[model samples]
Target: MKRFQRIAGYLVAAALVGYFLWFASSNLDIRVLHELLTPPVIGTLIVAALAYAAIIPVTGWAWARLLAAQGESWPVSWLTAVLAVTQLAKYLPGNIAQHAGRAGLAMREGMAGKSVAITVLQETVLAVAASLIVGVSMLAASEPGLAQLPDGVRPVLAWVVPILLLSVLFLSTVHLSPARLATSPTRAMRLLGKAGGLPGARIALPALAAYAFNYLLIGSGLWLLARSAELPAALDLPLITAAFALSWLLGFLAPGAPAGLGVREGILIVLLAGVGSDGELLAFVLLARATTMLGDVINFLLGSLWLSLTRRIAR
Candidate 1:
């Protein structure tokens, strides 16, 4: 069953990759692609890519600090490498692979697998909490017309209300607890561990800052890209970038869909739709995907080759 699932997952992942490749190729608006590839765009894309990579350190720091709470210290270099490499896994299919790879590396580094997994879980929970907080602010700042959304949407919002309340209440409770909780595998019990007298409130400020900076870096890069492409108005690009960030986050969370294969494209198309002609939007999306994927493919090849050589040398 596991083998079959893995095979099927690979098939789906492959199909998505192939689909994007062909879609980009066949629909290549040569003129638009050329314009999008200009110097300023090249620079913005480079900067955007760096920003995307930059967030890894903040995450590594978060993971390291959290693990320190459990009396474990691992090299930031090791953690940083694992974070960067495993990120490639996100573009494929399952997020579990990234977690699994990180866990294996952590285990190999002398930390318990469960402990490392717990740290990963803690980072995810806090990151998610941070995103939710942003979502609330976005909701508040937006026009209330969306509030008059369909009745069906109202129920979802209603559900969200209680969930948010519960989350905040739970966080308050955790905030009041003492620092230094046990490292356990149980999710329910672990919440208490996270909830304890830890400095989560203070930690949240930085985490929020990191998350915002992480996305803003990407957004600003895209803004530069848009400026190069001569796309109109910067007002909503940040929102589009927010949508892109949300999609990227979803890609990160997706099970086995490395970097969210169909996921990134899906998110990007939606975001780009309102701003440009279909021809222009499609061209931009294709170029953006190509730029990032090329770097990833190069890194993957380099890592694979290095691993193979190192093994041969030991023999």
Candidate 2:
């Protein structure tokens, strides 16, 4: 069953990637891409890549804090290294691979499997909540762009309430007290398993804040890419940021999209439709994808180096 699921996921991912390529080739002017290779634009892309890469350590920090909240003590450096190395797994067919990779690596490093599992669940929930918080707040503040979104897309907003409610329920229920668990032990166990525990407010709140900040960094990278494409000055940064955040959420939620590959770009193009010429918007989307890929590569390299150095020092 798992093997079949994996194959199906790969097929879906391949189709999405193919669609993205087709869209790029059909709508984007090749000349615009070449023109964007100017020294100044290249510099901006580099900066944008770096900005995207910075999210890795912050994510690692948040995860580490979660672990600490649960009475697990692991070095943040090691945790970050694990995240950086596994980061590429997000591009794999199933979005779950990255979390699995993290769990596997942490377990190999002597962390309990149950702790890793629960913390990962907590992290996923918190991350999604953070994305919604940023995306919705920004969208609300920038009503003009919200009004511009296609009518079909507007219904997605209705999902916000249910998703938030579910997230809140998961975070709260997972931390049921021992006495409460004992009363409905079977039901609670089914819901949380043996590994369920919630991080305290101090830990969760800060982690949520950090994840929100990471979204800003992600949006800033896209904004930089848009600027590199010489988009119109009238396009508000908040709108652009909100576009990316919402696109990211959509992508993240999508199944078998491989880091939200085609899905994110498609949504971004729709959201920022009037920001620039079609050619420029296409160029900006392609550049934004490239920027993030480059950032992931940078993070993987830096993380590898960190792990290597730490091992050497310990030896």
Candidate 3:
């Protein structure tokens, strides 16, 4: 059954990627892209890429805090390095490569496998919750953009309100005091894992905040990309941020889409439909992808360099 599910997931992911490629090829204008790549725009993309790269350490710090909360002590730098390098694995076949890679690498660094697994779960939950919080709130604030969404998406947006409420309730109830780390058998902890208790509210809440901030950084990068393209001033940073966050959530949830590649662009195209001309929108999507890819590469290099330097010092 698991095998069958995996095969179906791969098929769905492939179909989504194929559709995105087809759409881009059909709708994107090469001439517009060439015209859009001005020197100033190129510089702005570099800055945007840097902004995306900055998310890694913040996420790493949050992950490290989760580890600490669970009685695991590891330097934030080490966790950051592990996270930055392994993050590139998301582009691999399964969308889960990064998590798996992170687990393996942390284990190599002497972290317990169970702890890694628990932190991964906690991180995933927190990340999704943060995305929903930002995406829904920002979307609500941008009534014009919300009104622009297609009818199909409007229904989906309507469900987000209740979902967000339920998520908050779920998060509120999952807190475990630090004293109960070893003996807590609460259902949530059992689900998270019995060996290592879930992080307490003090830790989890702050980590959740960090994850939310990461989304803002991500949105800021997209906003910069839009500004570089000379997109309309009326599009506003909040609307673009909301669009990217929502698109990011969709892509993140989509099985097998490498780092939410096709799914994100497709959703962005739809969400930002009238903000710019179709060609301009297409150009922006492609640029956003390039900017993120560049950021990932930069982060991987920085992480690798950090590891190498630390190893040399140890020797």
Q: What is the C-alpha local distance difference test score of each model?
A: 0.58, 0.76, 0.80
Ranking by lDDT: 3, 2, 1
Q: How high is the lDDT of residue 258 in model 3?
A: 71
Against the true structure, what is each candidate's TM-score?
Answer: 0.67, 0.83, 0.87
Could you tell which candidate, 1 or 2, scores higher by lDDT? 2
- Which residue runs does candidate 3 get wrong by more than 4 Å? 1-12, 149-173, 177-189, 192-197
Q: Candidate 3, residues 33-145: lDDT per residue as tens digits?
A: 88888998999999999999999999999998888876799989988999889878999876778888888888987898877977888888788888878888777667667
TM-score attained by model 1:
0.67
Ranked candidates (TM-score, high to low): 3, 2, 1
Q: Please, what are the lDDT tens digits per residue for candidate 1 over residues 17-116?
A: 5655665666667776776777877776766555555667667666676666556787664566567666576554445676777677668757877567
Q: How many clashing residue pairs, candidate 2?
A: 0
Query: How would you encode candidate 2's per-residue C-alpha lDDT over 13-97 as one tens digit per residue?
Result: 5665576677677787777688889998889899999999999889889988888766799888789899998889899966778
As for candidate 2, its clashing pairs are none
Top lDDT prediction, candidate number: 3
Candidate 2 segments whose C-alpha is farther than 4 A from its true place: 1-22, 147-182, 185-190, 193-195
